[model samples]
Target: MRALGPLALAVLVMLPRLTSAQFGLLDDGLTVQTGREVHGRWASVLHLIPETGRFFPAYWLTYSVIWSVVGTRPLAFFVVNAAVLASLLAMLAHLVRLAGDTRVAVTIAAVAFALSGPAVESFYTLSKAEPLQLAWIALSLLCTATAAARARGSLGRAGWTAGAGVALLFAHATKETSVVLAPIALGWLVIERRAKPGHPCAARFAASYLGVAIVSAAAFAVLRWRYAALPLGEGWYTRAYAFDAATVGPALFRIMAWLVRDFAFLLPLVAVGLVRDRTRGPLLYASIWMLGWLAVYLPWPATFEYYLLPFTLGAAWVAGIVVGDLWRDRAVTPLAWPTLTACALLWVSAGINAAADARVQLVVDRANGQLVDVLGGLPRDSRVALNMSPINEYHFELPMHLVEMKRRPDIAFVRPTTAPGHQGETFLVTPEMANPPRPTVRIALHEAAVRQDRAMLDGLIASGAAERVYETTQRVGILEFGIGRLLCRVAVAPILDPTYCPTERGLIERRTFTYGWQVHRLVHARPIAATMRHGG
Candidate 1:
């Protein structure tokens, strides 16, 4: 049982790879632009607070640090986020042990968190505030627990407990959802103190944490009042689906079904933990942790599955407590079937998630890689015209900066409609122009930019300036198409006309929408398009 703890950790470090796909454009692209182009410093990043209505100073600072060290390499950022995941697991494991669970329970719980499907986005995305806040909240608990159970003197205990308060402040700095963490941690402390009844050190420890929570709360309220003025409890994304008010009730019901489907695997363990022992056990802490976050998610409009990552800590502890309870109970003998069943269920759910990842994870990665190779191979001092959507820019640009920007082999990259006074031995980079309506021509997308892009591509082809050197079709994965359909059913998502592109299907990843990707490069340009100037 003792050795099980280390083995579970070994598995956790490897399990995160299960959800790895290259970063999407919105978060990853914005993050990359910060480092490679848009001043990556904290001063430049903070300007976004008023515009975006989000105050994520800590999240930006982490990226600035990554940019300072790795210089825009996505892999380096991934490694750092993986370390955050590990720290998160370490804190959860410590919490479970403090709750009096056996090593077997801690081991199972740690492994479950590493493989959680609903928590994948936090692990996979380059920019997210959710994971950071969870780590901060857990660190607070670790500090408080260490102070209460191990520190001997009042001064020593308060010193250790002060660290917990700092952790809570960090959590509030990271995400809006963190408003729930303080009450959960503080409530559990108060409950524990009630059970013990007037130990001087316990009273001191609880008072310190409560004071920290209050200070953090008052500071956070100021930040919220100044910024984050968006009121989104009415399920704002539902407006995108274009549902009638009369039909909204059923649509919301379907969304609830989807959320339940995504969360079903962990639900049972959390339920059992709450029901089994909420009086003075680990179950009580787990209940507060789970219920607290559930309250926040209820009003917040973003119902995406990845948003559930904040609940991973509570879910993990609940699994450990409930399973540990079953493991220690000798009354249900026969080699502990209940404990074995719970473990099997966790693995089975993980298997299902892994299968789903395999189906859709590689689509963007394949296209992004091809785009890099095409751009990387361009001759030095040559001018190239490139046109694609902003989301595609994210998929294509991060690697461009990391792998190609340093070299670009001295080649010039530009939009299809080159500006005045720009002339060179130029080539046009395009995607499946032979097939229309191209993504650039979609009305829902920016109209003026796409029209200029379309005219340039056509003029180049008609003038015989474009000589096709490399071409490949990138199709949207079946799973991506299915997710779009699910979104449509959950709320009457607009059906994009086939006139927009060859494929009727579309998908949204972190609010960056895409139809599909296809790469077609025209080499040995005659400079006619580059020399020609078009007015906007």
Candidate 2:
């Protein structure tokens, strides 16, 4: 129990490098940090525009500082992300202890939280703001707990309260969903003060928290007004994918289903803690924290797995409380066996999911490495057109930045639209303009897009419009498992290449799962025109 915290810290410190082998600065990483060069100013990185309504000024500033110090080294970014995640995990353990959990329970729950499927995803995609948001949230909660423990009306209490408020502001700045933290903190304080009726700092702490929320809100509004082209309701990105009123019910259902599917074991423990410790102020605070995130996510237009990070933390804390109480009793009952079994199964499920993710990451890393090699081999003056998904572009951008290439000015990167009947137009790869100075090199990256636009790729190859420069291939193994069948599924799935069913007899399956990239060099005009005329 005593060594678990240190062991967890050591593992977290290495997690970024372990899981991020294939990851590169892409999407928000580029749009928010490296890609700002396209707009010719640092202000572009702020992204106050309505297209991205989530104004993360603090996040951008942090990246700017990193960029200045590290000059776009991918490892530097990974280190910072790992550090933040480790800090978040440490804070989570401290929070569990504050809730009166025993050391063993705190260690177990914190380890579970770190290994939770969603947390693994966050670690893998370290470029996103979710980890940073989690860090700020944990920090705020820790500050609130510290303030609650301080002497009434003392400077220590006041200072901790102010720190909590500042942390809350940064959390919101990292992600708009963190606005729930303010109310969560207030609720926690209310519960704590009620438990200790004579606490002199209660009123003052509440008022200070409220003042912080008000100031944060006002500051956010001013920034939005000054920089955003439209309000949240008017933003295209928000309306299209994030928060559509018409689809809220279905979205909420899907999100809930996802939670149940991923965290079944942890959810039951949380429920037990909530019922068992309902009267305890700290337990109530944990419950409120978990519920607050659910309330925010229910109406969200899209509920990505990463959105479950905060909820996972809350659940872990509650589960820790329940386990701690049980451990203190020191009695093994009939129900204890099943409870222990469920916990074991939960961890096994998480381990399997993490392994699957790591496998996919390795495949991606191989593909990205091949692409980088091909790109590096191209002529220094080549003007290449990138016709791929945003994710693929980000993968490419990271390596380019690391190598400090001067190709950004010459590269024409286009993220294809997924709209119907626009597949050909999306690539813009025609035989007519297959000449120099107009993308002499074209790369078909991302397997899904390649599969979708196979005809276009075939046409280019057949028409002699372009010659294949490089290619690479890899296979993906998909794992399927359910309750009471995980161990069987793991044992049989890899060896037999079949969907493992615990009871079903001899159900073998085979599927083609290959992903890679293909590069083509534009041919001279004469051959291209002749090939096109003959409908090659």
Candidate 3:
């Protein structure tokens, strides 16, 4: 047990370094940037609005206040995250003590998850809300579980239930998926009640849990209503990633593959725990919470790695039970050797993960430094239009939401058009290709232009409309002759050019719209336009 404590400490120390590669410390960067914007009293970008209370001023203010006092360095953020994770570990250790085998429980929980790829990804990546959400979830679980072990009718049970409820709201606000644990927490309270009939503690716990649930749900409803983000009346099809089952199946398969690759070691342990305790309500609740989330996620077309984060706690708990059971099994011959082998495997995996994680940290630091360089060069209060969504980069630090470039009438490289006829006086930009995916947000521009009922090519080439012309480089720039308004759109992802429209070659050859803001051939840049930056 003593050795395990030191081992866990070592893992915690190394976790931050290991998990930094793929995701980087994104949340901190985002929060810090957002905090600066907040301090500056600027309105957040439309996309940056919080749908839940978790990201509201209260939570952000806490982070901002901490930053003000401690200085806004990455290390400060890392320390906070590390401390939260360590506290969760300590809570798990307390649970182990409650279960009466501190050593085995601690080993099982720590080994199964701390070294898993998901844990590394969720905890190490700073920009993601997952770690913070998970921390609150863990705290909630710990509080509820501790209350569950007490004798029925204990006087203090109500407080623990209230604490769990508060934590639940915090978690929910942090991430919507954290709601999956509600049923589990409720079941924990219910099961505990069965052992202490007529006990005031049991009733109070149940009441408190129910109260918390109602309050959290109400608060969320109010928030969503305020933001007009309520799911009500919005068909499932309206969701960003909700797709038909046929499409969802393939995406689900990919997500499953990712899970397998990242969680190979813990899978067996979780399976064993589930198979052995199918009827235990808490166990079943955990399994249901996990499987239920997977089922729900399977139908989403836009599932990402961060979506799998909330399940880490449930998975770790099950893994711990499975490992403890495996250790106690008499049928397993040479138990010492098997246990030692497992430990060694976990240690090696942890070490390899840690090294890889350090490399990730290096990438994140480099990216962050470069991003700061980019922002620093921009003049203060510059009406900068981001050609792309800044959130795509794990460690991107642009104050995109607060830039107020939307009102400046510059070509918003993203989509370049709003709703129908909302293209404003600014020229709406579009790829010459006929079909553009929603992923590019090019659909919005195309749809809007179509709604305007303009002959596509003719509108682009019309007098006062933007004229297609060549630029100095290979990048294409529309030169408006009639009106002084010309738009140059640049795509910077996996570079795409009309020349490579694989599905439709003729779409680019057609000429319809002439570039100009006026009615006829009018003004042109001193030189003819030629080149356009291909969308990456």
The predicted structure with the larger lDDT, 2 or 3, is 2
Give me candidate 2's TM-score against the actual structure. Answer: 0.75
lDDT of 1 by residue, 279-395 (tens): 135666566777677655554332444566766667667766776776776366443465457656645644344334432334444455465556567666656565534334442
lDDT of 3 by residue, 1-536 (tens): 65456345645655545444221223455565566666644333212443422233335554655555555555556666566666666665565554445367667776555655455555555555666777776677567655655665676666676687778777766656555454644654566566435445435444455556666766755664565343533534335445465546555554554444344455445444545532143355456556655665665555554566556556666556556666666366345345545544644443343334333334334444443343333333332222222123321333431232112223232222222333222222222222221111101123233333334435435534354332111112221111000011232222222212223222112212211111111133221111222121
Tell me, by lDDT, which candidate is best.
Answer: 2
Q: What are the models' TM-scores?
A: 0.67, 0.75, 0.60
TM-score quality measure for candidate 3: 0.60
Tell me, by TM-score, which candidate is best: 2
After superposition, the stretches of candidate 3 with alpha carbons farther than 4 Å from their true spots are: 1-30, 37-62, 149-155, 185-215, 226-238, 241-243, 270-285, 330-358, 374-530, 533-536
**How does model 1 fare in lDDT?**
0.55
Give the Cα error of residue 531 in candidate 1, in Å.
23
* Model 2 agreement with the true structure over 24-113: per-residue lDDT tens digits: 434434533454452346576466454755567766666666667655455565666666666776787786765557787777777667
Q: Where does candidate 2 stray beyond 4 Å? A: 1-25, 28-51, 186-215, 222-229, 239-245, 275-283, 330-334, 385-408, 412-449, 462-465, 482-513, 524-536
Better-scoring candidate (lDDT), 1 or 2: 2
Lowest summed lDDT over 10 consecutive residues: which window, candidate 3? 479-488
